[model samples]
Target: MNRRSLIKAAGKAGAGALAVTALGGAMARAASTEPRAASAKPRIHVGSDPGIGRWSHAKSTSHEAGWTDQFQGMCTDGTYWYAVSNEGDNQRLHKLTLDFSSTVASLSAPRGSDHIGAPTFDPQRRQIYVPIEGPEPELIWKVSTGLSTVGIVPLAGRTPGSPAPQRWKCPWIALNPSDGLVYSSVFGDPERNDLDKYVDRVWAYDRDTGLLKKEIRLPSKVYAVQGGTFGNGGRNLYLASDYEEAGNERKHVYAYDFSAARDGSAVRSWGKVAIPDADDEVECVVFAHLTWRNARDTHITVGILDDGVFSGSTDNVYFRHLAVPSPGLI
Candidate 1:
């Protein structure tokens, strides 16, 4: 069976039966099937401002059958939201209302584009920035907020003195308004499963010239960065790992001190919290001031593209609404 079908079968086989404790902790499972020591009790991180804010299971919403595809990244423009997905026949950039009540529009990725990352909105220009895995040198596309393609710019550089062949896929992006620089997470060797070969390296680029400004190697533990967004009024940066399976290590959303990373320092690992759902893989995370209309109340929301438990059903996008303390955003 194809991977999606297998995923459905895995869910029906008991994945859906997995439940969260009242405290939002998922039952721990071993990363491999071979017998091993008893897994330690899962650590439940709590508190309003414990680095990564304490998260609670809010709710989940499913997508339609035709919408069954890989969800990569997401972002909102206060008034509307955009999510990027690719694979199968569902490759497109989706535009939705803030509440996901409806899809306002959709745009097919440029021909030759293989994958698209979560989109970043350029409020000053009224456009959305989307990165893609494509052609010889990958490119970032500038699409109008209305979901129309405006133009594309070739990503102009790579990590220096690396022995690995240059193969680029820009899967996450954030526009730091404080300095007009674009930070992106790039992956190498798309076909390799060895995590180290394709691990993520974040780069800051001059928005006006698209020239590489600085790059920092992420900690070796961050296997891949699925999506990211600016937080703390654009002072801090957050990156999310796309999901690993239940038996594997926990998926995390990590926060970083932006200024340090920009100054050629190691991307300091600030704080992180495990996403609550054990069965699903979190495709990406987008934080926006979606509640209370206050900067302090910005909430973190993640898109689960592959977690499902029901039988005879195709998995749709499942959004887990997370509640982080308002004081934490500041």
Candidate 2:
């Protein structure tokens, strides 16, 4: 059976029931098979400013069909939003309306590439930068707005004089319009001993040639980074983490200042924004200029994969729109 059929069958087989619990001020949903410990709490590292401010729960939309299940990451072209999903051998990219009210188009993963992660849009090229993992070496694929593959940038072996082939499991990527560079981070726990020493650093690549430009060392160890986007005229990078443990809630979006690192100064104090849903896995975050009620406004959009409702008939993907004082233009 296909992935969607399998999800539906599993849902019918009682995988949809979720146990809800209140932990502190947030809520947690425990699956029927695996229960969470009552003592579990999210790990919070809120900077003094916490720049994003309180995210107002705006609106959420769920996709139940075959092509759009298990959303991994998302980006916007100012007018429309593009999302990527991976299901076993089936990986697809979907185009949706700005509000995510409906799907406009869907395309399968490019040949020879399997798992697709978060994607970013390039306004100059009018293309989407998709992070594809597997098929030996990972790649950053440049795709057209119509969902067609236009170019490919091999991520491995880009680091000069590397002792071995660098296998960067790029789960998320973002575009810096000001400098015309694409940024990506290694997936999973960067602090883990088994991971490469450089995994903790964010890699920036030239947009046109795809050559390794430079690596930015993070001020702190960020674990399980799933998605990231640029804001404040590409001066600040916002990253989302999906690290969750029995006693630690690592589902947070962090912001780092790029300008602070340029002058050999301390990378400035970081900012943090917590994802309210304790049960859902945080996916991707993007900044978009959206039109609501014929009014244009900028918003910080976050994608959450609601595992808590996987077994139920409800939609599993939640597109959360957050209101920030000034999201800054890209």
How much is the lDDT of residue 150 in candidate 1? Answer: 86
List, residue by residue over 187-224, the lDDT tens digit for candidate 2: 54433455532235677777656666766777777666
- Candidate 2 has an lDDT of 0.57
lDDT tens digits by residue: candidate 1, 6-89: 224432100000001011111111121111221332232221132564655454445654334556656666555676666544
Deviation of model 1 at 153, angstroms: 0.5
Error of 1 at 208 (Å): 4.3
Q: Pairing residues by index, what is the TM-score of model 1?
A: 0.71
Superposed on all Cα atoms, model 2 deviates from the true structure by an RMSD in Å of 11.5
Q: Candidate 1: which stretches are off by over 4 Å?
A: 1-50, 53-56, 65-68, 158-166, 187-200, 243-248, 292-298, 307-314, 327-330
After best superposition, candidate 2 residue 178: deviation in angstroms? 1.7
Output the lDDT of residue 70, model 1. Answer: 57
Distance from true location, Cα of 96 in model 2, Å: 1.8
Residue pair clashes in candidate 2: 15-311, 16-311, 16-312, 42-249, 43-249
Top-lDDT candidate index: 2
Estimated TM-score for each candidate: 0.71, 0.73
